[model samples]
Target: MLTGLKTVSKKQKDQFEKEGYLIIKGLFSKQEIAEIDQTFMEMSKKTIKGCFEPIMDQSSEVEDPLKRYPRMMHPHRVNDVAMKYMLHPKVMLILSDLFNENALAAQSMFYFKPPLARGQALHQDNFYLKVEPGTCIAAWTAVDKADLENGTLLVVPKTNNDEIYCPELADSKESFTNQYVKVPKGLKAVPAIMNQGDVLFFNGNLIHGSYRNKTKDRFRKAFICHYAGESTTKISGFYSPLFREDGSKVEPELNPDSGPCGNEFDTVYPH
Candidate 1:
């Protein structure tokens, strides 16, 4: 147990199973959130090779904020604090109950959605993770308040069991990523509005994405991690080296890069 937070209840689990997503309020404490914010804040001041590339100087009036604060990919591989949260006990425990088995940490990403930054296009996570036998799940922790004006995440309900669809090219002007999945007929995208310390967990197959950060001052930062069930035997090559809750590495077989989206549209983890 994490102090004031209660363990996940059956009702919560049922909501996740039925709606394909669940939001747990204050999963991370204020102190923990501060730690994450500080870690990334310091990281933004320098470049970390493949993990993070930021144009430290953004004083120009015309410079894009994203260029100076692009999303940090696979940061857990380089930062201990990121790895700590990726395998946070409370999150791992909830994943265990959700998957009915131990959960393996597969990937960690930190999005610094600075003002006026373009959002990711709608897409299914399994399109990239490709976990065999079972799909991946995301534990997205908001490091700052996220809402429509700040480009919060948007998700479509009842799409967890749907097959991964080949995405169409998204409008380059609005989306940072090219891939876009159309919401199924009759279903609409809803905002997963969250406050600092809140964590939203969603299925790998769920259709989700965000829009551009329209606000001038707000930054919708988030610490996102993906996990697979212990039974998973293979995953995308990009995320080959998974980690267990105990901080031990687990190398699952590499799932082929060419997946449901086909070779022409083979998914790549955005750098």
Candidate 2:
């Protein structure tokens, strides 16, 4: 167990428990965010197979900027910096406090919400991760200032413990991803405005997503990761070989349940 880690306080833990999400201001330093920016900026110029496949040619037939700079999936498996943040001790410590047990690093993603990029639809993380016994927790680090204009994340408070609802087809005009989860009655989705270096941690079942980048120049870039507790016995095969805080691999049993829609949209979509 990690000792003497002062990242998460008792009040913060209680807030997360009560609201289903918590935002830690400046959880990552400005220097750290700059490093991430430089790394991904360099990466955007080339293709890394299944990780990142940005199109360098702007004159190509693909018009969408996201097609040119798609969200990088499982980036930690390829980039040293991404892996460093995925298992960053401070994040691991806070996750331990939230789970009340050791945490396992399961997945990492970097979103380059460039100008004119479409936002992801509201959906649950476990709907895709399929962590059994408990749900995954997402640590979303905003690399740039996030607001409604630049497509900041949105969440429905107190929806953490709700059962996974089958998703409906999303409006392609607004969302890049096809899956969309409807907010339950009496619940409303609210924007999570954050500054650079801030990290938002939310439950796996939280109904959350963002709107299209309504601004002309700003890009709402973010570094996001998902984790499961040490006791997790199964997880989706896509995120297999979960890692420990020490960087050791642990292969949990594969979870085959793909929610109500089967695996039609299983291919990596914006998240």
Candidate 3:
């Protein structure tokens, strides 16, 4: 017996339904963003066995910045701050509104897309997570200002309702991820220009990705989390041991097979 969360308005839900995504300003505070900035900055210096392992040696010869600084996968497993934010009340509220059911936290990632780093190519989350019956949703929060020149996120509108598409090979020079979802003929790739603390929530099937961090000085840092609706019965093991807002875990059934994207090659996390 849960009433819909009032934190999210119907108008906002309508926008998400129409666009497959919506950007909420100041969903996190300046102080919160700053703390996250500090935490990840410190984490970048050291290597965590399985969570975060960034190369500290400043080697200019490294053509791909990601080789030197890789993204943090599931820091919430070891960091309290990240865990708190992943199950933040506001985020869960917005997600509940979007899913029309309770929201279950699935996966979390932190991207430190440094200058000249390769960006992830366009792809659908369902192609990976394989959430059954319904799809996953992503809540992406910018830790720094994100814009076109600094590898801001790019998304195609109205693709939320589309089926998972098998991705094509992407240009290695521009994209770090191997798979790229082709945008439908009529849709256009739009930029998500966001200030620090802005959260962009989108559907699992929304065609979205980031571009190369072209700037020499800026790092497009972001915290991205994925969630499954209460109705979901199965998902890829890559996102198992989901969590509830109260800091408890919920393990869903495994999806067992590779999604439409196939298992021809190894796949990394896509934010």
lDDT of 2 by residue, 137-232 (tens): 999999999999999999999899899999999877778788899999999999999999999999998899999998878889999999999999
Per-residue CA lDDT of model 3 for 84-134, tens digit only, reads: 889988789889889999999988889999988878888898888889878
Q: Residue 107 in model 1: shift from native, Å?
A: 0.6
Worst 10 residues of 1 by lDDT: 258-267
Candidate 3, residue 150: lDDT: 96
Each prediction's RMSD to truth: 3.1, 3.0, 3.4
TM-score result, candidate 3: 0.92
**Candidate 2 vs 3: which has more lDDT:** 2
Model 1's alpha-carbon lDDT is 0.87
Give candidate 2's TM-score.
0.93
Q: For each candidate, what is the lDDT? A: 0.87, 0.86, 0.85
Give the TM-score comparing model 1 with the true structure, all chains together: 0.93
- In the range 1-271, model 1's lDDT, one tens digit per residue, is 3555356799998999989999999888899999999999998889998788777675732466777887888899999999999999889988988898999999898999998888888899999889998799999999999999999999999999899898898877787677799999999999999999999999999999999999998889999999999999999877858999999999988878723211212235431
> Which pairs clash inside model 1?
none
